[model samples]
Target: MTLQANAGQLLVHRVASEVAKDCFALATTFRGPGAYARGDQLVRAALSICSNIAEACGRGTIPEFRQFLRYARGSAHELRAQVRIAREYDPARALHCRTLESRTTLVIKLLTRLHDRPPPDR
Candidate 1:
């Protein structure tokens, strides 16, 4: 089956796809299988960003998509934060975290621009 690309939905899809790829890389690096398991949490948060965006867009409502974009942005931020936490635990992973952080920041910018509207005339 082929994925039909929708112009209105491109940004979210692109950002989400990139995020998913990075998350997969992150998951492989994560060694949090023991107590206080954070691996799953990180993966969930990362995936949630993309899933929420897709779900909202699928609903076919601008407002709904905006709201979901808010959550998606938050998820990106959460993943970035989690990456930092992991970096703290393992300094060597700083490079990986930095890369993910950069991509996540771009996602936030695109979402913010898409959702933010100009002020109405008085």
Candidate 2:
């Protein structure tokens, strides 16, 4: 392992970076008209997915990271729900949100696996 490198950190860092960048794109592309207020919900939830993972990975112990991963997972699920809302309430943004939601789900899957794996002993 290289300096400042570990399985958890590597996974969390990459996932977080992706989430951040993706959310930025989503925000930029968001349309103004919305009756369901899905735009704000999606932006927040998508951002949370990465931030929580990064925060959890930097925690003091594995159990703590697990707690954070749980948060990240919840955020991922919320992001999916928010995106789906676009389909029902804001049809125009639905596809774009779907793409972001799908990516968020993949990140969630990866994080869940990382959370389940045994932590390396330092």
Error of 2 at 88 (Å): 3.1
For each candidate in turn, the TM-score is 0.79, 0.73
| Span of 10 residues, lowest total lDDT, candidate 2 | 1-10
State which candidate has the highest lDDT. 1
Model 1 scores worst on lDDT over the 10 consecutive residues at: 1-10
Q: Write the per-residue lDDT of candidate 1 for residues 1-122, one digit (tens) a residue.
A: 22222434567568767777877777677665441356677788888887877765554556665677788888888988887887787678888878877888888787787567411222
Q: RMSD, each candidate, Å?
A: 6.0, 3.9
Question: In candidate 2, what are the lDDT values of residues 12-98, reduced to their tens digit?
Answer: 557656766766666565565763254567677777877777677577577777787789889888877766666566577677767
lDDT of each: 0.71, 0.68
Question: In candidate 1, how many clashes are counted?
Answer: 0
